[model samples]
Target: MKKLFFAAFTLLLSLCSFSQNYQLISGDQIKVSKYSSDLDIVASDKTGNYFAEQRWSWNLRAKLYKFDKNYNDIYEKDYRKELRGSIFRGFYPIDEELVMFSTEYTRKEKTFTLYARKINKTTGEIKQDAKEIGTFPLEDKRDDFEVKFAPVSNGKKLLFAANVSNKDRVSLVTAVLDPQLKREATATIDFRFTPKQFSIQDVFYTANEKIVVLGKESEETQVGKRKKKRWVFKQYILHIYTKAGKKEKEIPITADQRFAISGKLIEHTDGTLALAGFYATDPKKKDLSGFFLSKIDTDKNELLLTSYKEINASMIGQNYTEDADDDNDDDSKKSKKEEKKKDDDDEEEEIPNDYVLKSVLINPADNSMVITAEISQLYVYQTQNRSGNMTTYTTVYSYTTKDILLIGLNAEGKVKWVNSIPKKQQEKYENPNITRSEEDYFSGKTAHPYFSSFAALINKDKLIILMNDHQSNNVNPEYGHKVKRVYNFKKKSNFYGISVDLVTGTMKRKMIYDNSSDGIMMPRSAYINGSTILIPATRVKMFGKNELKMSQLTIK
Candidate 1:
């Protein structure tokens, strides 16, 4: 009888081990830079076979690494050494062996040029000489210039657009280039608006081989014919242009005055337009109070503006962790204090509204769209003295991410449900207010090491949120469900995932893999291609040198 019991116990343990969400694929490891921000993973044409990564150094020096189907590094090289003072715009994959990149250079005085180069995928070498396609004349140091490249005509043609601004005038120059970098058609649009009033959000390719530009332009209206000099916010504007850059139709989306649209817009597979952002209820307060989702039917020229969801305590995963505080003695006093404060004031817990909208993804399986947002804020620190006084003032920036809000919208642009994956990530900024060093002129340390680190994988019936293990046993779970004690092979932990049901809004948190025995995974570097998820990690050994590794997880 005792032998039978031992055998049953071993069987149960084996069953639990095999039932994990992700299985690690070993033996595919390489060397990489310690800084995760420098790595950019590009999904290749071969669905789940191979991919490419571009790493940039502190001085904007770039190196491309190509990996094979088994996650083995095959080749790496540095291209375009002559164009040192250029900014990489985008990469276009023409075929399996050929890729092209666009860069904007502002080297000469009062001159800006856009260059395109074709790259060999196998060897990471430039296929042809870098060609200067277009140039823009700058106006002093205050002039703003930007160039973007997009693949139109079903990835057969490339469309390049440049936004040049001087004083109160902004000109948009667009050119369609073929695979040989030859410009087929070019046109320019000039418009005038208040300084900082007009901004181009995104340019996308339409199904009919035309281009659509999503923009936001603020307009001012007089109150009671008194001309109070107040600039009121208007609606979002859409400009549809033909292949030759001729303006075909101008569609205006009349939005609520309380809300603001983000620069990220989605042109869906079915000819519908959607935008995800925030709205403010209080006019005086410039902060966002809720999530705003707008769906536009371009065929009928109808806009839907009734899909706004408010951020509440329940949406931030506060309800689940609240009950666990009662059982733990160490947290009892803190929980009591919070309850006392709540009772003292007959008011509800104020949910924070400083979340910045990140991405709006569409799921054609169910005609549902998911909105992902994170809490982001900036702080400025300055040291000032009056009359020979030596004093220092430290202002810590809130680059920390408190929680990520996820909202689901159904086919009719109605709110399906809302959920939040709670997390706390904090770090200091190198400068006054810059969070990401890659965005600033000077490459410095990141504000929060894990600010925007979590990855959300959206599916038809569920969504998975994956990140590095930060909570472990430190976070309390709901009282009823027994939280499993996680064990790491080494001192450090591996990756964890929170799976949420799309329809019921139910969430289950579990450790995907305890890979501490091998390497420390950078969850922020995780990428999804079809049903496969790839994560890069750092492997430290007891002797010898450390190496960079990647984990491939296949979803069944």
Candidate 2:
């Protein structure tokens, strides 16, 4: 009997050891300059080869790296001399070629020109000649200039659009390019709204070879009876245009009596449109109470299916408190009773605040969808100082990114399951030094920008989430207790991998590795290539020597 029991226990241990369905491979460390701290994966090819852009702290020029299938760095190219006075836009894979985009502003002519050059994917050699994509005249050299690129038809075609607003109206210079970097069509389209009241949010190339532009428009209106008047969001608009820049349809999306705080538009394969977002009933409050999904019949100008799901406390998981140890105390029991009574007196359900929908994944086979949202908030603190006649004001911003919410929906737009993964992280940045505006800070201009968020991928039947967490979280693998807050990701932080069963919403978590001995892994820089996820890790030393490596996680 003793032998049988021992054998059974051994088998259980082995089963527990093989629970994780993935393998992590850490590549060899390579010495890099101290200024190169962040790496972003720009593009990947069909054969599992990828390209990364290494950013420097001092300049806009970046180094390009080409990695092989096994995460081996095979080629490197520096762009400092080649792009001396130009701003690097991005590197993208259009069709079978890797294209690099850069912009040059000629102060004499007050013109900003966008140039695109081809790069050899395997050799990392950039072509000397560049093709001019667009040119815009600017009133001032300091004015903001941006060019938007959208890939369509499984990356077989590219769309470029830029705002060329004038005094009277807002206009966009749009162009469509084929795989060979040849312009198929170019035209200027009017937005029909003033620049101050409307802003373009996103551009999409539809499945039927059409252009869809999403814009947000705001207007001022009276709110209260007399003196409490204010302005808020008016409506969101969508303009659908043909490939030749002819406007086909203009649709305005509005929530009945409620404010649509945030939303995302999705284009189906059959030329249908869907909208998903969060909503708030009270205009005075920014907290969202429910989420809605709607499918639209564009031709009929009506909604085919609309579903609204209220987010309650139970959907966000139990609120675990640190006072569990004090449960036996009399005062604690009394306090809990009073809190419970107060909760019972209130009729409104507790809901999550500052949650933003991040990504929506649609399964190709059945059209079932999974949506992911995160709690992101920014608090600004101000301080004033007086030195004789000179008065100075300083500002500091505290950024918080918390729990991740996952919701699953069937093909008919019905909610199947909902789950929340607990996590807490905070990052602080001071003004006048690092960033000039909140938008710049949110764009990752601060130090240690990629340490706070998570990277996620949806595999065949599972949703995988990778994040840097506090070391103590490994003690309770079931995630029953309150998540320990990680103020900063450092060497002591542990990298965690969570796998969720898509159908049942069941989750399993494990600490994949610790950064105590290796280095700090940036999860936000992770990208999926085929069945593998690649992340960049960096270790900075006291001097100018730094070590960089690639970590790959392959789903088994």
lDDT of 2 by residue, 476-547 (tens): 233455776665456347887777777888887777767766678788788786568888777767786777
| Candidate closest to the true structure, highest lDDT | 2
- Per-model C-alpha RMSD: 9.3, 8.9
TM-score of 2: 0.80
Q: By summed lDDT, which 10 consecutive residues of candidate 2 come out lowest?
A: 1-10
Model 1, 1-556: lDDT tens per residue? 0110111001111233223255557444565444323444554645232333333543334556666565555666655474476755445554333454545545466777778777766566787788888877776574335566665654677777777766667667888877777787777776545445766767765565565677767665553344455454555577776666677677665355554534356666665566666666654324455666676554444456757766654445342233343233222343335334544442221223456565676675787777777665433333333556666554433234456677878876678887666654433433332225322211112323432357777654667667654435333243233332222223434466666676765676666666565566655657676556777666645465446555676544
* TM-score to true structure, per model: 0.71, 0.80
Q: What lDDT would each prediction earn against the true structure?
A: 0.55, 0.66
Alpha carbon deviation, residue 5, candidate 2 (Å): 45
The CA lDDT at 236 in model 1 is 59
lDDT of 2 at 7: 10
